[model samples]
Target chain A: MAASAGPEIERLISLLAKLPGLGPRSARRAALTLLKKREQLLNPLAVAIAEARDRVRTCSVCGSLDTSDPCAICSDNTRDQSLICVVEEVGSIWAMERASAFRGRYHVLGGLLSALDGIGPERLRVEDLLRRAGNGEVREVILALPATVDGQTTAHYLAERLGPSGVSVTMLARGVPVGGDLDWLDDGTIAQALRARRPA
Target chain B: MAASAGPEIERLISLLAKLPGLGPRSARRAALTLLKKREQLLNPLAVAIAEARDRVRTCSVCGSLDTSDPCAICSDNTRDQSLICVVEEVGSIWAMERASAFRGRYHVLGGLLSALDGIGPERLRVEDLLRRAGNGEVREVILALPATVDGQTTAHYLAERLGPSGVSVTMLARGVPVGGDLDWLDDGTIAQALRARRPA
Candidate 1:
């Protein structure tokens, strides 16, 4: 007898549909693709999911998902303890790691200070970051915040608050990304913005 | 203390890199995307994977994976028992189902007979299909095989063997898909070459 389409496949489709840029059609295609390649893809994927589920946990000190509290970076003696890189989200921290540009310890602010969304410093990990910094090991703070208005506001808020504490504050340079287009630049006497880039 | 990176994350990155269309960068991005959306996407995806791992099984009769053997189409009594549509793979079966054009039984050949790959009739589900057809309920067989040389060879072999068994054989109508063009034509041309379709 033909069996009814059951809850298991239905649940898988529903979860897959929730991914960014995926809808029901793409979800169905992906599910079927995974099903067809069960030996090479599906089995390993299942095992990976199980292992990650068992091992992943939130770092109590930094709120980054790690297997332990204080995470590896926070506990690493070789990393610069005095220099903290503050980011808006865990994803941004991962992006920084991929760039391999910064070796400093990280502090995830969870989100920006957004008045429209009613998000303020109290809603973030800013207080914890300040407390940790006040322990006197932190000497310099690098703000790797997004360039949005709320991000800039949050950066300013931290700079004003931490400046009086005698910690040097810096921001990541803002300009063109490593590979950006000049043709997309608008208007102008074009004479001014070109002169601003320095050999930092 | 900061712990160094471990083999688990490395294993995940390597495995994810092998997925279709995902390079190392996109794989890393996707992995982090899943992690950051854990409550919304990752956890539920994990749950679904676990559930599917426990429930999915191959149809003993057709070699298709489903929650039950003989699948939904095989078991449905209202579908035409006298007509069996032979297809190359489960993907084709799913595509046909999406069209909602055929209301009949399906016999998945698993693959076309390919000399280059040294695949033969014995390597396909041809034996199982023959056994099922010999039971005498089927009166018509539709060769919904691809129009590739191997696919045509497989279709011809089936027609030759099945002709003496007293059954009428048919194939899909010839035409571009409703929105498709001749520029996209390939294996499908064999079907399309059979006729110019009248506007329905």
Candidate 2:
């Protein structure tokens, strides 16, 4: 709206400012860089953004963002239908995918249980997970939850509920991660899960 | 377009993918995380992006991106008219500003002279720079070009041209930065330019 600012610059700066570690000044610099490199960075980024925006979706069965409703893993006939890898978020699912070790389908729990946040099992898709596990085809359930206390609590709760179903339960190996989100983990982690995986 | 992906997740993925280091898969994961924490990171990021985009602009005189045209520095009358700092890009200008050392105006050359790409002084605003230098107000020209060969070439050429214009020619101190972009340098190097600056 200012006489000095153009519409394109304004749009770019605003979007850039919202990113992590960038403030208003940094955002302005970033926007200028994009404009200057529009032929290389901006146009391609715009195209990539549009394509991803149009194509990405969530798997209804597991809540993972995928191009397919059931996703490639769920639809793959060779993948183990009798196993489901339960994770706290879609990022965790992607991390598992990056390792290329998991042959089972994924079930994204959306988030971990947190008492401070009053996030009950009912608030999450815990019921959906239970209903899916009850379908009788699943032979194993892997809790790829975080190593935090909340993550442990959520994993325990799920294991307790699914135990009576006679299905085997497992979890990702510890010490492969050090922080909050599994998405930030290196590919080595997912591979370790395949090598040293044990029953929960 | 896929039955599995939803609008929110898609939007977030597209947005995240446009970042410097993020690819499609990483973008998707980031989007999903933001969606799960929409109230915390996603919505605020979106709003900040929009606001910055709306407010940021290029300084008409110096080409620095800002909320004002002449920008805060260019409009400030207290800055020395007898000294003009020449930089390769607006990032360099910002680096100088962050140090709060320079009390003169800036002239951004946009980029260095590159013969490999057939970029010459004509492509850059070299003529405008000469005209501005000859405007009778500026008494000294300080070159703050990158240490790259092309950057040094441009600085040399500018020095040669501005020599006859009766303005003193000097350059920022060297050896402080080793193969790093001037943009990435700390404010200390920029401030040191004022303290130990030498004849070009």
Q: Which candidate should be chosen as best, given DockQ against the real structure?
A: 1
Instruction: Look at candidate 1 and tell me the lDDT of residue A136.
Output: 93
lDDT, candidate 1, A31-114, per-residue tens = 766777778877888788667667866677777666667777777788888888999987676677767778888888989999
- In model 1, which regions exceed 4 Å deviation? A1-6, A115-118, A179-195, B1-6, B21-23, B37-40, B113-122, B145-161, B179-195
Candidate 2 regions exceeding 4 Å error are: A1-32, A38-61, A65-83, A97-105, A111-125, A135-139, A146-157, A171-200, B1-18, B21-29, B47-57, B67-72, B115-118, B175-200
Docking class of 1: acceptable
lDDT of 1 by residue, B66-178 (tens): 77777777777899998889888776676777677789888889888889999999999988887767679988889999867998899999888777777887776655667
Please report the interface RMSD of model 2 to 1 decimal: 7.4
Error at B87, model 1, angstroms? 2.6
Query: Which pairs clash in the backbone of model 1?
Result: A2-B75, A72-B2, A72-B3, A75-B1, A75-B2, A76-B1, A76-B2
The local lDDT score (0 to 100) that residue B85 gets in candidate 2 is: 93
Question: In angstroms, how far off is B183's CA in candidate 2?
Answer: 23
Residue-level lDDT of model 2, residues A48-124, one tens digit each, is 44444456566788887666678776778998988899988877765676677778888988788899999989877
Each model's DockQ? Answer: 0.30, 0.17
- lDDT of model 2, residue A189: 62
